[model samples]
Target: MPAVCAVLAGAAACSGVPAGFERPEQPVPTPEGYVDASDPQPISEIAWRYGPAPWRTDAMGDPRIEAEMAGIPYAIEFYGCDQGQGCTDLRFVTRADLRDSDDPDKPASRQARVWQANRWNLERRFGKVSAGEEPGELILEMNATLAGGVTRQNLDAWFDWWRVALTEFQDFTAR
Candidate 1:
């Protein structure tokens, strides 16, 4: 049967449509000019939203965005990508040097830094914190998964959480 349509209040309304012939609903709301949540976002999309960040390719050729938040330098490292498909995952990484409280000129011992990281991890469950590769350095990291796609609004919320995590870590290390 042909779909019956009507004009109501200058708006088009349809009815009597077959079960499989109805028009699809509008997509979920996303930020202006950003892709819908169901769409796989390319690196350029991310950089467009958060950029002016310096872009550099890693040894494996995946792109990374160098940026900072709350005075802490960090990198948005992309993973699981190719020339065809965009990256499926990304991580925000920041490393801060730790100093011994008793001796301002000295670096904190690895055991001491690990213990502090453990305490913070147990108390707060947002981002993961650990000892960095270098002595007396602590690493803070957060991950985002794009394999299933992510909404730009949700991504903004994640960045908000990252700022909070970084601030808390800075205060914790200072104390």
Candidate 2:
């Protein structure tokens, strides 16, 4: 889905930055996707740098589901909404210790990068971003969420939107 305005509704009435949204002293939300590179980063850094990774975004679950798409050397992650709400725990690693596999840009990696960029970009103007996890391969273990944003039967839709990006990555690396 195309990116939407970060401004939220009913969240407040203030305008132009929204009255600081609480002092900076107060810690930000976990999924806010904020972290200091100097201080060890998490796995979801991808969300921060990439901004809401995932091609086919969907809404389902208490914390929502996120999918990723990758074309061999290129990767992309699609951020999803859990139970009609956006997902929390947006974690990814900006500087990951990935293996020298035939295709370094896997779907998850691509998603992570995009997700990280997104979080970083949004947090700059909106607020602190929430992120976690160390850069590594996430076991393909999830059930497909059925209609109405139910994660009961979660599925991996990460690679769906990454085809184009991955192709670009591959094309560049191929040279």
Candidate 3:
């Protein structure tokens, strides 16, 4: 009995785990050069990087900015009760068509594959994806109120996700 207790205590000490308890796994660190979206600065940096974008007003008269990523154009729409409290939304239109058929109702296999690849890549980092007005357009939309207002981190993360998704989609759709 004494030998058994000594053995158990020795095992615990070596493993740094309590008796009958498992040690938790350490979290994997973020990859090097990867932007920490929650850090805030990355988002602002992206906005500055894409400066000189064309500006316009949305239907609600809110300001919007147009930019491009991976050869795809997108719009950044702002929404808020007042200028001081608004958030931004990203709208992206892909170059790929949903289908080659003339019928709008038919789903394009190639388009679907690209969309799925984009969806998988983006969803892992950002969130859910919804269909856009035109086929092949993807909207990674967020409501200011629901998202607790957009910050620089949000914009940075969106751009980062776009960069990754663009590469992924291109690879999947390559000839």
Of the two candidates 1 and 2, the one with more favorable lDDT, higher being better, is 1
Q: What is the lDDT of residue 166 in candidate 1?
A: 79
lDDT of each: 0.68, 0.31, 0.49
Task: Give TM per candidate.
Answer: 0.68, 0.21, 0.43
Per-structure clash totals for the candidates: 0, 67, 0
Angstrom error of the Cα, residue 64, model 1: value is 0.5
- Give lDDT tens digits, candidate 2, residues 139-161: 21111212223121121222222
Task: List, residue by residue over 43-137, the lDDT tens digit for candidate 3.
Answer: 33575464435655666655565666656555555543244223323343344444434556655555664556476555555333444557554
Candidate 1 local lDDT, 1-175, one digit each (tens): 2233334522433435757765446423444554322333344355445444566667777777777665666777776677423565678777878988789788889998899889878999788989887878998888877554556666777777877887887787776
Which residue runs does candidate 2 get wrong by more than 4 Å?
1-17, 20-159
Q: Which structure among the candidates has the greatest TM-score?
A: 1
For candidate 3, the C-alpha RMSD (Å) to the true structure equals 12.4
Backbone clashes, candidate 1? 0
Question: Better model by lDDT, 1 or 3?
Answer: 1
